[model samples]
Target: MNFKSLKTLAVNGKQVIVRVDFNVPIKDGRVIDPSRIQAALPTINFLCEQKCRIILLTHLGKPKATHDPACSLQPVFEYLAAILPGVKFAPIVPGTAEAITRSQEVRPGDILLFDNLRFHTGESENDLDFAKNLAALGEIYINEAFSVCHRKAASVSTLPTLLPSAAGFQLQKEVEFLQKIMEKPQRPFIGIIGGAKISTKLPVIRALLEKVDYLLLGGALANTILKAQGIAVGKSLIEESMVSEVKDLNLVTNKLRVPIDVVMAPSVEPDALSQTVAVANVPDEQRILDIGPETLELYKMILQTAKTVVWNGPMGYFELPQFEQGTKQLAEIIAGLNAETVAGGGETLEAINQLKLNDKFTFLSTGGGAMLAFLEGKPLPGLEPLTIE
Candidate 1:
């Protein structure tokens, strides 16, 4: 939980390797979401102010170590070049003779963004020797990629051990804000936890139940929970195996608030005839995709009374136009509230962007898996390596 801050480190005229999360969405070879890149600017700018030769380490997409052009960081590099004039791109990745020569050639204030780290299988395997090669390129290591901090990759995990490591500005802020919610959030705290499945969110959900007053459920997890109560969810996505676990959870927790109604359809198609139906009245062939209008109204009233609201995951299948309404409406409602709000996860970010309500929340966390892990009171692998003994 404790790590050195980047500003506290002495990196004047040093080659600093910064692990940033530039794993943004790309469409037709163009970066669609530059929020991750923008979030990293403060630390990158600060490193430049300290006259550090900023060597940026990041992965774009899931590449199978073949240096696939489709999974390239070239668009990100081009964006950086436009925003940051004179930024350099290494011709080769680490572990090569040319990469070694390139590392020595960088001057202070110069920026060097290497090719995708995932291009080498060693990065994800946490290969210490490969980490050592990466560390050899810099005297200091900075991890600003809290989104990927949950991953035990060589660049984020082992590389920090070989060099002086510090948490980047964005990461420090993420810890501070998320810690605020976990430790001492304001009175009448309301948590809205939803997503595709109950499996991925189980730990955080259990953790939230201990802290939040009213925990509202949405998405397919709500369907699974409903199924446990013997309610007919039609042909909705239900984790049948997790039904018994939900029964046990219900016996323990009274703070959970499930959807009273849901938007149902015969299929997941865009043109599937949708209808708002009571949770108990869903037809045998209908799939539940979104929260109903009544549930939205209930959530709005509950969110309005809260002093602090912590939200994660979309309330519905927001990527689909029909199912986006519930998530969209709730986003606007939260935007209008005076609560000190905090949100995390990729889908949550997507919803926030869909509504352009980013400025309304107190903190829109950059940490994804790291944020969830932190919320669950668990230590992150990428962060553990940065801690002082």
Candidate 2:
């Protein structure tokens, strides 16, 4: 995973295109969360220090290869402009004459943020022409978007090949930290995996089992494992298709820990009558929503002894107040531990952000799918061109 480093690159007074992940949550024409934008500041600021004319490229939401105003990066630009100096906006279509003109107009030590890259049809298609056109705007390409590094898109995979490419500071740091966890983690390494789908997390689960000393499960992912062992999950959500796959994993082991009790209710409504019950006592019509207090205590005991902890996803449907206790409590327990803690994924970070415990962890990765893929021992497409062959 060796790659060219941006800090060592010679980019004085040159136009540098940086692919950043500004895919933040926008609400009512405003950027709701700016963590992703803030994460790229170190790289952007470093380029500014090097007197580089920076052209920023990012996709806001899924535009689906159309010109959708709702998926525009205008809100992110506005947010960035207020906090950063010498920042300008290029609201024209990417890879067009207007875009080239705007990019050329960028002065040294200034940033010119382009409109949504996903607005163009070729960005997601990994089209060479689109990448070549994008490469024309700058002499160097820096990928600061680790969150989208797993994607094989034109901007991420193809554009890097068209220019002198390097890994940005954020991307470099992400790879280093994740690589440490995978290759040389401290003894007593613990992994906590949760979320709604077993299909998405199965590979990482299997990969972690080979490395981690203990693997704890929660959320709907645990329900499937419980069901595969002939345990009744009531009306809980479980992937029926993955049951056979789960059974093949040999769940009757000591390393993997499933929930012993859960918080269940007839419905997921906030006011729904919820009760904590042992795994074997769930009613036929009740749905499991969160891990119970007993299960939390068990997880806490295991976490207290961890020398290193890697967590992805939440312990429950943390969006709801009643079901948020398990995730919140676990986060607090981990925060108080004397361990090298790392957590990632969209929902996991959201829960951490809501808990205001970001500073407590050793590292909070901006990547979700990329983090999982790296942990699963898979090669990332966006990182391929930057690799120092």
Off by over 4 Å in 2: none
Pairs of colliding residues, candidate 1: none
Q: Model 1 misses residue 14 by how many Å?
A: 0.6
Shift of residue 243 alpha carbon in model 1, Å: 1.9
Local distance difference test scores for all models: 0.86, 0.90
Instruction: Work out how many backbone clashes candidate 2 has.
Output: 0
lDDT of 1 by residue, 1-389 (tens): 56799878899888898999999888887887788899999999988888889889898779865688877888889889989865988746665556767889898779998888888888889998888888888889999999998988999888888888999999888887888787898979999988888887888888888889889989998888888988899999988888887775662454788888899889988788889988889989899999999999989888888999988888888788988898889888988888899888888887897678999888898766788888888878888876767
**Model 1 misplaced stretches (Cα beyond 4 Å):** 95-97, 251-254
| Model 1 error, position 190 (Å) | 1.0
Per-residue error for 240 in candidate 1, Å, reads 2.8
Judged by whole-model lDDT over C-alpha atoms, candidate 2 comes out at 0.90
Q: Write the per-residue lDDT of candidate 2 for residues 1-389, one digit (tens) a residue.
A: 78899977898888999999999988899987788899999999988988999999998888855678898888988999899999988887778778887777778878998899989888888889898899889999999999998999999999998888899998999999999888999979999999999999999999999999999999999999899899999999999999988997665777899899999999888798889999889989999999999999999999999999999988888888889998888889998999999999878888888889999999999999999999999999998888888
Residue 182 displacement (Å), model 1: 1.0
